[model samples]
Target: MASSTSYPSYKQLKEDFVSNLSGGTVSEIALVCAVAPVVSLLWSTLQARQSFFKPYTTLGFVVDFLLNVGALLLSVTLYSAVPILLNLLLLTAALFIYALPPNLSRKKPRLLPDAKSRAAASAGSLGVLSTKPFLTNYRGNMMVVTCICILAVDFRLFPRRFAKVETWGTSLMDMGVGSFVFSAGVVAARPVLKERADNKYIPLGQRLVKSLRHSLPLLVLGLVRFLSVKGLDYAEHVTEYGVHWNFFFTLGFLPPFVALFQSALRVIPSYAGLAVLLGVVYQIVLESTSLKSYILVGPRTDLISMNREGIFSFFGYLAIFLAGQDTGMIVLPRTLKARKSGSQWTMLLTLAAWSLGWMVLYHLSTTYKYGAGLTVSRRLANLPYILWVVASNTALVSGFGFVDAIFFPAFYNAHDSKTEKEAYEASTSRILRSYNRNGLVIFLLANLLTGLVNMTVPTLDVSPVATMGILVAYMAVVTATAVGLDMYNISIKL
Candidate 1:
């Protein structure tokens, strides 16, 4: 729990950001830039061929494997952090490398058209870009990876604090939760929105019942996880969702409520509208109850009160999820097609504006809350926190859109063209696609590995560099397994 009076000063915040930005080394940047492509290329080749051991693909994997090992050794043996700018530059370069032809003489790769691409073609120019969900799977996989990375390392690994103790501000951990919930929300909302199951023709009670039935798996998983963590005496971080509750509660509880609201109302509200409504209701609850006390201070007797943070925070998380669904509704198309450069830029500008607007609202909400001597509280999942999530995520999605629109023109432009869009996509990021294909399985595997590592190793006591090495190796193992399964078209659907 954070103290209201313990907020960091502005100067401290600036210093921390600077420290974080300056943490990486030149060698680290070059290494990341060099190895990333090979990893992607290997995955792509294996996926495209669907063969375990082809001569060219096997060689690519061998080279990539050696690179991964070398990178790990160098990072642990010699310490240097990769700067944020270098990361950005590397990412941009990688996109260009993947999306564009390397030499004029080389043939352009071909990609099999997906449903999104097909839908975009029918939507026409501007409508095509706006009508479909934009790379939702890729974003979700990124979240899963981010979560795993955070879990793999202890706080001692970082040189600076990522978040202030008292403010519900932008910390890596806060963003992790926000990203996870927002992605999960979109997945939950997909079927309902696509099928029009939320029609008012359905009785509210029936809708609620059906929703609850659908959520049974999440509830069961939540119970099993809680027992596993408690029963196993795994490393417990008090701030990580406390003892009795976890993210599954929010995932399990929110969708049914969303369905109920959709069923009861004559006109379905936009995702943003529902989010605002939930935020207002949450704020009212915060002012009206002793919920804050139990969150920051533990209960004397009742265990449930001690875990009320998760219970209370569910609404704000739900709002974030609903907002994601709305964005999905606008950006995701049943099909996609190539558009003119001008149209793509127009779409990018629209997303940018939405991001900026949400950020301004976040700032205003934070300022208003300060008048009452309260800062943002991630634990509470307050209004400011929800706004921050929407703002940041919208901005992130917009950036990805810019990359996809500008660099990967084939995805949008393949309507009547002879381009090899599918082949190009495969070559560029088979690893990411594979991970996305079985994101849930990978996430579950990461969790299982996290617990196993915690039990076997002293994560907090380990040297920071060694921790980084371990994390890299762990991620490699996870990625290899995911890519391997995806090559065989084996998805563990749960």
Candidate 2:
């Protein structure tokens, strides 16, 4: 075991390892974003033809693990070397395999024989809700990418260009925090929309309490992480969040702050407009005043100053959350209605338009001659960063929806509830669903394992093959745990 006297040196070494990265080009980052959907499409295609591959159950699990996790590992590492070729190959394979007919055995039992009966059995019940399997798959894919990158970024094989940018730029890991928050905002739209439609607004105090209750677990986790890092003398990146603050703290306190303004937010006709107003105002404040300096270069004398990055960036993240909510409002309704109305084209067009619109706005914001000349910064989470995160994630969700619509149209737009349900069950990625069901648990486990690996091995000094092997083993453990829990119908929700 390493001695206590050497801990600080190890800390410095690890911190320096990830420092000063400039991140990748926007197109490269966008390509990385496309990886999850592409992999999901491949997995879903294989899953739909499970009857054809029924004899190879063990091979099925292997393929599922590879697509769900291994492909992501490659995206951040090897894919950087031959990105275009790898992406084209995966996509071409997906389309080719999808075109193959599922030769079902006549004697094989159907999973759901009476689809209509099953639908009728649950009719007029709370279970019959407007659901979107693609949304679930999108969230699952995001979690997988996030889990892969957290530890991979520590290895030599992981591309520095894909790591989190130091001050300002785009990167694959930089998208992790913003995208997670945005995904939360996306799902949050359901309840927000429900509240508005039901016209039963909870009291502000009660909402605040509820928000606190929701945030309490995250707060505890943040404290545990902070204490553990300090107690263990772990490698700390002060600028990433702060001296004592972590991502958990950022995630924890955001909800309560947003809850404080829930009433005001309700008054606004559009959440997107509110997001625009907030983002513009926040950007103006950053440009016109010393607030940006206070965050970027200010003295860390007190608690607030020490954690300025996490504190001030709150506004930008809040704006992002709102924008995501608006996006959900736009996209979710179409998804729910598409099943009955078969409006796949409408949903597809809506997603494409939103993706393009946000990307254009992001381009405009970062353009020196035509626009604000601001760069995307995860630390600051400024206007351009917000636009970029929203655009990229929206594009990812759109890609998943497109893949489902194109390759699994029967599953995506079944005419009746029974067929749709049956098709969804058949085509959905079970491992991805497991990850989705217990996201927080998986993330926490990944963090724990990342720390364990860094402590046990010199991640910065490992060879490429060693790095790959370690990462594969790490992800296999994580996914296997998720699958096991899912098999037992266990979800460790926090």
Candidate 3:
């Protein structure tokens, strides 16, 4: 299928944004939000018959529509101290590095035969006992640091509810985007996976064909979502209280999109150019008309939500994910290997910037508007808001790079090989091998845990100290549980 829809040029996109006397027209609208891509994936998955049931699978989804309403009601009954909840998160982040072990490296007692204790002795060099355990420990440390950012910084750092302004609780949304960032990081490290791709090699053409051949779910799902949503206008059932089972729709197209990007960028020297073009076009949609007001900022003053094409948060994430893939291609070379490190605390502190920044941003501004005063569009996020995420991304680099340093010890030495075998690792060859194992499952668990905790917690009623204590306790409990399960070898496949 041709993806050539004549998407806008970077210049055209900029011109469109500037042409707006008052943010332009909504007629050129495209994507919507996170759910939009999810819907697309869900549709594709169903059509592919990859899933057995009729896709009503998210837990507490059906059972909790009523519960959502109950929580909505709780808002009225409870005397909320929502700000305190946020402060607690910030406080936990401030203290996180201290609670963690001080040493920066992952070392273990060598269970070896003859000269096995030396870290320098590669399995081949010293005749066998692999260094994977020490490497896994190192990756695990980085993983914990990143998870700290996930649980304490992004996960817990934001107000739960805002009364008058759509952007008042912007930090919470920032945390949500963190999930996407972390997920993308895991995807980029596909070389670290335990799976041996050489043995399972399927040509790119065949892979694409297989992917398309399995896209029946996408067709059915998109059609069903389009029909149920557009034709019947059942959005009342879909707004926070409802579930559309849409991830199936988006997943169908996203992988193909990623693989396609990998192939296209291999030849094209302008993937960044492509991203800039897409980003500018999307920026036009953000600044123009009431488009943002409806799809991203909410209340849907018009029927414009029906126009889910190339103009919303969905487009933003796809563009960003593509950008991420391009980045991964540049960074993840074939010959990666693990290293030992002793700087865990430093990495954790650097990542802590995200939390501190969010705390400061939230304390200073209550909204997500991008420009100066009176801006109501959350979609038109302010310079600081955008900058905040940039800073967060910067913080993440310290964490991810720290991990890469250890697990990808041979990172600097890698070169693309014909078989990609020297470049890649597994049992026959695998790299660091301790990247995110069950990403989606972890995402679900994090989101679910956030929901369950928020559901039971008191509103502004809790003191700042008390709230901070609770947030830390909750995050620790949730993270440790996930880590424990991972340690025990029970999780969704990587």
Candidate 4:
């Protein structure tokens, strides 16, 4: 009997990898980001003599708590360790304040309903997180810790060799952990991130301008950043993307690119194929001529010109962006519902299959840096890594769906709804919901937070773990605060 077996082609494999990579990281964080708001809603409900817990909103609290652990691990560390001490101080103060005969808020304000509360202002952004009567207690610490991590960061590592300018300009270290994933994933998960579901019928010029606007941030940042490479140009140095805001530079154009793709997606099958063709052709051209230098180089209008490595590689990124948008259309479900349990086994099997594929790529690319999964070259996005991303993410969604199925009666922890599990909380939901809407904003703030951290703290003397801890705690608070501010700044037109 003819065996029903066929391997994913190189292109197919890579496509899958990139798709899941974008989806997994964003969705996971998005869920985590949702936690506090939903919790707020739940708390609000309980205060109103409502149900035990809100609807799917409880998922937001779970997501926040889980993600905070991850954020602390990735962002906190020795250099920005002030938060550790400040956290202690804040906790002590909170304990003393709460322990007083009267609620501190009573003497000062009716804190909850007061329109004056802002995420960055509230002790815990008014999310009512934590496992005690001290929910609001951690709010103050959250802000200081957030500021310390973001504003007072020092990305330097000790006992490590000095990094050359070129290395920093090009390597993944300059990008930060999950940095490329942020940009590449944005490009990949175009459908969901974008607000357009019916842009297919839109025209091209409109799309171009739309793309321009979305990419403007990256475009401007890219240009300015290129200027930042002046020292590297003269001294034969390049950056490794360490603590630099490259994620913003790469992702700025995404908003517009997505808009363009949506307008052009009516024939996604054909256009998507064409996008791949265009990418292949562009890559071949780079490899064909010494024009790689000319083509890769950006606006050499001066002595200290920025090398627009990714930006100048327009066809390359455009291909990737289109490929990503297409992925959302092809793989994303129109509705959130499960038809059967078989999907779980299917997802697991696929994950295993993809993991095995990555192993093969890794073994083959042993000579390349970063496990050859993502070569240290800024100009190239490794095929294997992209595949790993897609598969990894697809697997997450699939597995979650399946698990939700098996434990449908027990473990229903999915944030597949706009609202929470039930309407138990009120004020909290309104606040956290604002954060979900401000994801890209949160990301930008995180970059600025990183910058602020760099300006104040000197990471050169600290350990990576310590630095990571500081940064994560700081980011968590900043994220919470920013979300709170957004809620307060709500605008509507009738």
* Winning model by TM-score: 2
Model 4: runs farther than 4 Å from truth?
1-67, 70-153, 156-200, 217-249, 254-279, 291-305, 313-316, 335-376, 382-436, 462-473, 486-494
What 10-residue stretch in candidate 4 is worst by lDDT? 126-135
Q: All candidates' lDDT scores?
A: 0.57, 0.80, 0.36, 0.38
* TM-score of predicted structure 3: 0.45
lDDT tens digits by residue: candidate 2, 1-494: 86667344766877888875688888987777777887877776765654533443677778878887888778888877667776888889877877888655533354475864575466432222345678878999888889998999888788888878888888888888899989888877887667766778888888889889879999999999999989888887788888888888878887887777677765777777787788999999999999988899999999999998888888888988888888788766634444556576687778789889988989899999998789888889899999998888888888888777665666554545666666665556777888888998999999999989988998888998889999999999999898889989997867
lDDT of 4 at 20: 14
- Over 4 Å off, model 2: 1-8, 49-56, 106-129, 334-340, 411-420
Model 4: how far residue 300 lies from native, Å: 6.6
Residue-wise lDDT of candidate 1 within 320-357, one digit each (tens)?
Answer: 98888766664554343334445556666776888888
Backbone N/Cα/C clashes per model: 31, 0, 56, 80
Deviation (Å) of 428 in candidate 4: 13
- In model 2, the worst 10-residue window by lDDT is 122-131
Which structure among the candidates has the greatest lDDT?
2
lDDT of 3 by residue, 1-494 (tens): 97867887533442232221222111111111111122222222221222212232343222222121222112111312332333343335324533444442322244455543342344223211122222232233233333323323221222232211233223323333533543353344353222233445445786577557545655565555556544533212132211332433444455555555545544655444444455556656555766655554355344434433222444444554444443333333322332123333333454455446533543343344643222322233333333333334433343344433433333233222211222223111111132244444444454455435434653234565565555556545544465456557776542
The segments of candidate 3 whose C-alpha lies over 4 angstroms from its true place after superposition are 1-172, 175-179, 189-253, 285-311, 334-391, 399-435, 453-473
Winner on TM-score (1 vs 2): 2
**Per-residue lDDT for 243 in model 2?**
88
Native-to-model Cα distance after best TM-score fit, residue 120 in candidate 3, in Å: 8.1
